[model samples]
Target: MANTSSAKKMVRKIERRTAVNKARRSRVRTYLRKVEEAIAAGDSTGAQDALKVAQSEMQRAVGHGIFHKNMASRKMSRLSGRIKAIGA
Candidate 1:
């Protein structure tokens, strides 16, 4: 479908970027899952630790353009709130 050499190069770049983005997304999800599991288990300290890591990963993702800034903030907020509620 790519007629020009430039277009072909663009296609290849996109493929590479897609694979990278997919890996980043999966990594973020894994961190989130770890936090969620810790929270569900009612381990406040573990959840807090995981949340810290997850938040770091999320912010890194935002920096990498994988997630919107607001979305990352919202997710971090919700996770922090949940962790706070664990003690209440």
Candidate 2:
């Protein structure tokens, strides 16, 4: 569908970016799942540890433009609140 060479090149670039973004999204989800599992198991320390890793990954994602800034912040806030509630 891309007629021009530039358009074809752009399509290729888009494909590559899509794959990278998918991987990043999956990575973030994996970290989130780990934190949720730890929390569900009622392991406060483990959840805290997982939260640290997850937070880092999430912020990295935000920096990469995979997630909106506000969305990442909200997710981090909710996760932190859950961890705190479990601890308390």
Candidate 3:
């Protein structure tokens, strides 16, 4: 129902942005899941490596506005803590 030209343009922009954001979110989740699986398997080294990758992905999500700064920070903190616990 975008009657105005600007509104129509905005709708298109939003659709594109939504697709990009969804992909980013999915990628981040995949990284996080890998870390979790490694942790669950008791592979400390693997978990640590996966955590590093997940942290980077989460930070990128924040930079891209796909995730809030605090949310990304919180996830990174928790994952790091878990990884440390696995080592200890």
Q: Which residue window of length 10 is worst by lDDT in model 1?
A: 79-88
* Residue pairs with backbone atoms closer than 3 Å in model 1 (clashes): none
List RMSD in Å for every model shown: 0.5, 0.6, 0.8
Which 10 residues in a row give candidate 2 its minimum summed lDDT?
A: 72-81
Q: What does the lDDT come to for candidate 1?
A: 0.95
Ranking by TM-score: 1, 2, 3
lDDT of 2 by residue, 1-88 (tens): 9999999999999999999999999999999999999999999999999999999999999999999989999998998899899989
Per-residue lDDT tens digits of candidate 3, residues 27-84?
9999999999998998999998998888988999999988999988988889888888
Tens digits of lDDT, candidate 1, 5-50: 9999999999999999999999999999999999999999999999
Please report the TM-score between candidate 1 and the true structure: 0.98
Give candidate 3's error at residue 28 in angstroms.
0.2
TM-score of 2: 0.97
Clashes of each: 0, 0, 0
